[model samples]
Target: MAKAKVTDEQIIQVGSELQKADKNVTGHALCKVLGGRPDRLIEVWEKHLLESNSDENSLQYIQLSAGLEELFQSMSNDILKSIKSVLATCEQNILTQADKHVENEKVACAERVSALREQLNDANDIINQNQDQIDSLLKENQIINNKYQKTIELEKSVVELSTKLEGYTTAIKDKERIITEQAARIESINAA
Candidate 1:
C-alpha cells in the first residue's frame, strides 16, 4: 500500500505544537502524531533545531561582545593609572635633581667667593710689604744724597784753603830777598 503524503507546512506546524505542549518532537513522535514517514519528519525537525540553535548562538555572541567591551575598558583604566604613576615619579625625580643641582651650585659659588676673598687678602698683604720696602729705600736714598752734599761742601773749603797758602808763600819770598840785600850793605860799610 502507498503511504499518505504529508505537506511540509503540516509537519512543521505539528512539530511546533508538540514543542509548545512540552512533548518530545522527535521523528517517532511526529510519525505517531501526523501518521507520516519518520524520515520526512526527521528532516523537518532537524531544520528547526538548527534554526533555534543559531538564534541562541547569536544571543551568546552579543553577551560575549559586551563582556569583552567591559574588559577592554578596565584594562585601559589600569594602563592610564600606571602611566600617571610613572609620570608623577618622573616629575618628582626631576624636581629632586634640580634641587640638588641648585644646592651644589650654591656651595660652589660660596667656595669660589671665599677663595677670592682669601686671594684678595694675600694681594693686600703683598702690596703693603712692597710699600714698606719702597719707603725704606726712599729713606736710604735721601741719606745718601745728604752725605754727597756734605762732601761737595768740604771739597769746596779745601780748594779755598790751598789758594790762601799759595799767596802767603809768595809774600815770604819777597821779604827774604829784601833782608839779604840790607845785610850785604852793612858788611861793605864795616869793611870800608
Candidate 2:
C-alpha cells in the first residue's frame, strides 16, 4: 500500500496534542500517531524544535539587554563619582595656594593657577566626551528595547496563529464526523 499523505496542519496538531499530554513528541511517537515515514516525521519534529529554540533565544536576548543596561548605568555612576572627586581635589589645591604668604610663593602660585585652569579645561573636555558616550549608549539601549518589543509582538502573533490553527483543526474534524454519519445513513436506506 502507498504511504499516507500527512499535512503540516496534522503534524502540528499531533505535536500540540502530544505536548498537552506531557508526552515526548519524538519522531517515533509522531510516526505512530501520524502514519508517515519516521524520517519525514523527524524532519517535521526538528523544524518544530527549531521554532521553539528561536523563541527561547529571543528571551535570552531580552535578558542580555537588561544586563547590559545595568552595566552601563553602573559605569556611568562610577564615572560621575570620579569626576566629582577630581573637582573636589582641584578646589582644595586652589584654596591652599591662595593661603601662601611670601612674594616669590605668590608668583609661583599665579603660575600654578594658570596650569590648574588648563587642567580644568582638559577635564571639562573629558567630561563632555564621556557625556557623549553615555548618550550614545542610551540610544543603543533604546534600540535594543525596541527590538525586544518587536520580538514580543512576534511571539504574540505566533500564539494567535496557533489558536486559529486549532480552531480550524476542530472544524475539519467536525466536518469529517458529519460526512461519516451521512454516509452511514445513506447505506442503511439503500440496504432497507
Candidate 1 lDDT over residue span 22-102, tens digit each: 998888999998887798798987887898899989975564467788997899899999999999999999999999999
Per-residue lDDT of model 2, residues 1-192, tens digit only: 865599777887898899999998888898999887878887877787799899988975564477888997899899999999999999988877776546678899899999999999999999999999999999999999999999999999999999999999999999999999999999999999
Error at 71, model 1, angstroms: 3.1
| Best of the candidates, TM-score | 1
TM-score of model 1 vs. true structure? 0.54
Query: Worst ten-residue run, lDDT, model 1?
Result: 59-68
Off by over 4 Å in 1: 1-67, 176-192
